[model samples]
Target: MLLEDHQLQSIQWTELSRGISFGVDGGCLVEAVERLGLVDIVTVSIVPGGQIVLEAPLGNAAAYWHPCFDPGDSLPADWAGRERFSAVRSAPIGVLVDANGQSSFAFSFDCLTQEGEIEFGASEEAKTFVVRLAITDGLAAARSTVRLAVVAPELAHEQAVRELSVLLHDGIAGRQASEIAREPVYSSWYAYSQQISHDVIMRNASVASGIGCKSVFLDDGWQKFGDGRWYAGCGDWVPDTAKFPDLRGTVAELNAAGLQAVMWIAPFLIGEQSAAYSGLARYATHYSEHLRTWVLDPRHREVREHLVAVCTRLMRDYALDGLKIDFLNDVMNYAGTPSTGDVPDVGDAMTLVLSEIAQALESVRPGSLIEFRQPYISPAVAPFADVIRANDCPADADQNRRSTLNLRLLAISQVVHSDPIMWDPSAPVEAVSRQLLNVFFSVPQISMPLDVLPEAHRARAAELLTQWRALRDVLLGGELSVGLPNEGYPVVSSRLGSTLVVAAYQPRLLDLDLEGVSELVILNSTASSALPYTVFGDVPPVGSALAEGETAARVVEFAERGFVEVPAWGITRITLGA
Candidate 1:
């Protein structure tokens, strides 16, 4: 309902719901574009420096590619200096490109004119600008690349317009059913190993409400496990008496604890001993036989109906809030043959299954949050999901670090972003806290296990979530600013009005001209102390080409200074009035 039209000095923009038109002031560009339907578009200016190139993403031919770093491939000498900013996360945030190829950032959504405040004018007071993009429905995509495009609103909607109109016809090629508008994210039960206990679930949920977190998910090990089967004989959703002791009692307690109970369910993968499999079951697809554990025969109307019925009973009988639909790895490269000669669109099959499951859940509880973990099919899954998990967390710090790179890279290349609520690994308290803080640079929840944490972690989790909930609105809704990252550590800062949130990892120096910024929040991930908080009007006088327009101020560091050294791995907040 809100529309923003920036007045570019070089062009005048006109907009209508049907399409857009543009006119030029002193050039032929507008004249050519106006005839071609380019108007009110997100604009990108290619500053000639930093040898960054833009390529078209695989499926989307309209957008351009960007700068990249390949740890796997040997590159030309000094590759870092010769590149463009291929920062997809920063796409929503303003990015700074330096002459020597390094990039810093400052996100200023506000525009202004000569007067103090300009209404919808090119002034610093008005704030609202975003890249326009359209998501097409029923894509015939194999893989996708992250390509950034400077788009106008009209252009963004135009490209995605087809998706809105396309209707899914049952078993008719790729399209399956009508779409809905709610965005979704999925839930997971701490990777594949669910070792969760009833008491642990209740303890976690009790605190989840205090931190304003929702979705009390009782992950793993609840189903009765039988002999000679790892995950078999557990397809039926019966609580393990050994684990739950009083299963119904536990569900009742969770409801009273102010948490929406969400249980994890893997649709397929029946163990050989499972009652459903022990009796007699036909392969859903001939390919299901090849899968490790038994794959559910979703193609069978009975199987689909039974799956829906069980899920519905959890709500109707148990009063559970939602379900964490897990283990979709089956579709990862699955090329199964249906019974007939007609092959189903692999993408369509995935979509249909998702649609059916989503419909079943909604019919039971109109507002239930259906979460899934499909980082691979993120772009496709994003529109339909309520929550999306980035991926299962690896067990150690090194793997945890790799997850960051993979997750960030995935966010860009796939052109989709998701938050992983898995607990921060048993890392150094500071490391864990700062890691969570940085993840908050984008909108993600801090879903960590606080019950078993040692003293420091418990304190950090409580303090971090407390502060996060108090400022989540600002973090989720404010303008973003990111700085150049160093090896092993990174820094990103954001501001919403007078409140400033800055999170820094490892020990380092951050000197940037936060033009209108009046605050600072620092989260030091390193065990050592950092210097001081004095401001300097320029980039550090290091061995470099600090450009002419790059005005900056340094917050002086006091080595061995007592008060200003940020806590090892603690989030700190500061306020500045501009």
Candidate 2:
């Protein structure tokens, strides 16, 4: 739609489906445009080519937005230095915005379960931005589609991103994620990694249950002993009897402890040391030199069948309520064996595999949760995954904050989760509080061994979890508005009904229209003790509570007070007079 004014000499364009199409060597690039108000949603379906380049007038574009795991500001004009790449489990959408956060251009591809590269380079002579979208693994044998949205200059970047999400969601027919997907979890990955025992898990599960976590996100090292081999023992989904002698009993124990059991499985990674690798190596397209594992090509019926059976047996035999499927994006690294599999395209193969697995797991137990991590949270994978999580940032709270907020925006109706929050057992209470506050919007995943943590630290975790549980609706179900993303989102606020909850990662002004809120909660995640604000209406504060339960600093004269100070790294709940 943005190419309406551009003229090309070599290529001839034709009208198709109220849009445009052009020919490539092997096939045609078809763009179907659906206009929603002033926004043009252009779906570009292409048969693999070297790349597809579209030139658009580069007007007033100052900054760019990508679903990045880290925080940073990038200018589209500076694209000559570096190109951005995204996969199923990484940043999958891109947008160029002006200084006021208004989107100039936005685009996202469907079926990016594999890696796709989007390059934004300026055409100095034409005074336009040359947008290039390509499959990094080279031209595919079948058509893959990328949707581009030309948003009005008045629409904010967040709104533009959500528009793309809506287009992708409907085009792919993604489902409304179940409520169970949003429940808080306690994961064993960061705490124990590959080294975990049944006894250790049970101890943690009891403590986790007491701390308001609804599920035990059992991570890797369950299928094999903690030999520190690092995924070398993957591909086999069976639990190591020594570590989990009674795997079924372990699930039952977790259920009895009021925690759902979710196991971790990597179906694509078959370690050289694994028995499955010996039998299934023929189905693999490439051996990952970095992982030292054979990446199975799921296009093959044998590979998909093998993985589905393994996942089904694991869920049925162990009575697992859910699974944390990992390393799926590996399928994008290489094409499947030529002329050997039922599904040809890597994207199609993955979709089929995930669909079959989800169906099979559901047959075993109703409402079975399927969790996929970042980059993989695209529309194509949305129908299958119940929860989409931030990538592994471990102890980085700010990174988790950025990652989760980005996820929340792109994953519209689906459940988004943070990487399991892990902190030092001796970390200061405020430091621990910051970790919890950072991922306040998404479902919390705590990876600390709660039973082993210091009493004060454990109490803090419990307190925060309690607080989050009480405000889960306002946090997740409410209207989300985030501050400048280029600033790593210094402020994030959600409003539901009459309640407003704002988390300040950096102390700043709260210059907001406070018309609808009867209760305002400000969470101070920064080291600063106070956040400044200006009141707009006639309402005055009637009651106040500090997050740490510290004595009040001072009673503010609302008519003249400019700022309110609370305990550092704590919250202030101001009850407003009606």
Candidate 3:
């Protein structure tokens, strides 16, 4: 394997089957080769410092891939080829940590065109940390290059992330920026699903505006014949007069109500019943049995132009504020289909289409928001999107948090958003608050029907959303700290200058150094009625505090020396004295 430190010894390959070979090329590139009809595994061992921090492409899926632990022990042989919605879960980057929680070494894939995975596990027999690079599909027969670096242990995590970002940016082509990247949005997917109408949308937009949501996204059911069939009206890109007699008027009404209008569109998918489906048969990548639709081949210039034109017209015709592009990952090249254009790979083609769409839309509506989700969330496509949201996890709060953090760590300057929060409205206020707390670090998109919510739920939601808006700047742009994967991120906090915001997902003792912190707001996500915390540093005992939600007034002060308890599932703002 390639080593950053020349003094380091060569990698010892414990198991190298006959069909595969490893070598160093140009004194820098580490090349691994596998012949036809052979499944090979390459293993390397190293002794890292104190705690090892493994960075996975996606969120924590302990059963499949763990950052510091070996998921191979329980992983099935077919795990490498297992069908999944995202490829980040199997991304080829692994960061090694030193004793003091600093980065010691890191391994990354320089080639973005191929699909691969780097799995780590402790080798008890070898007494050294083992990493297995599992390359398959496109790279199985061809050569694959993996880059290794020995980072200085003194490098801070943020610095390391910045460095990594630069490296990735150099390798990729675009960066994303938008004014609405961090703004709160209201989505109709979870709330209305396929059952949507002009009245429902206008009603939701009015309510969303009252709660400080800046944008209203009409998702999935606006196009003609877009009812039960998800993409039946996809390629046409025309409004369904049945659902809304005047689509333009609906958008105008939303704008009148003080909400930016955003719509969801899938550019690379064509329903079988669509008029263009039969005519564009040559542009089909493959007929997806799962989606029951034809995935458009993005490599074709004609197809890319069509997508760009459709998006530009939406902005020019309806005066939309943004477009949420869904199912972008479907445009990737499949094994059996040969590309129809000069593009070398489908990824490059996908990026090209995205760039064109972004440019065209922005030209019509400057600063228009373009949003994408996981799988297609690589640095290469960042330039084409203003907001990158976590893949849909529905009511699972932990997964939503983990996904949001994963995107935030990689997307860097881009707005990272949580999956639309859709929970049972009848649930306890505390439980509902837990869902909100999980995604507190990123932009929150609410997708529930607030009009039908209970009075108590409505009040609680309003209070939390108001508080969220008050702290939006710091929470979105501040220095962030997250609990390790092992702990399931029970605590996540962000600090901007002297102001700190902390969200506790579990009942754990939290210690904060309030040296420069003037205002500390703690949000408890636990089920308990109160949250116990400790504060130290240059701050004195709390003088006065305001508790909103279920928090009782008496529990605001530090009940036990240095320990302060606040109401659970609510926000508590604590003022510190010098």
- Which prediction has the highest lDDT against the true structure? 2
Of the candidates numbered 1 and 2, which has the greater TM-score value? 2
* Worst window of 10 by summed lDDT in candidate 3: 46-55
Rank ordering of all candidates by TM-score, starting from the highest: 2, 3, 1
**What is the number of residue pairs that collide in model 1?**
47
RMSD of each: 14.7, 4.3, 7.9
Candidate lDDT values, in order: 0.41, 0.73, 0.64
Which residue runs of candidate 3 sit more than 4 Å off their true CA positions? 1-91, 96-105, 124-127, 132-150, 154-162, 170-176, 229-233, 333-337, 530-542, 549-562
Off by over 4 Å in 1: 1-193, 203-214, 226-229, 278-280, 285-291, 297-303, 336-343, 374-377, 395-432, 442-452, 481-489, 497-499, 508-513, 531-565
What tens-digit string does per-residue lDDT give for candidate 3 at 137-253?
A: 344322333343322233433345445555555645454466666778889999989778898898777778877688888999888778885565568878888898988899999
Ranked candidates, highest lDDT first: 2, 3, 1
How would you encode candidate 2's per-residue C-alpha lDDT over 263-296 as one tens digit per residue? 8888899877777778898888587777777888
The number of clashing residue pairs in each candidate reads 47, 6, 2
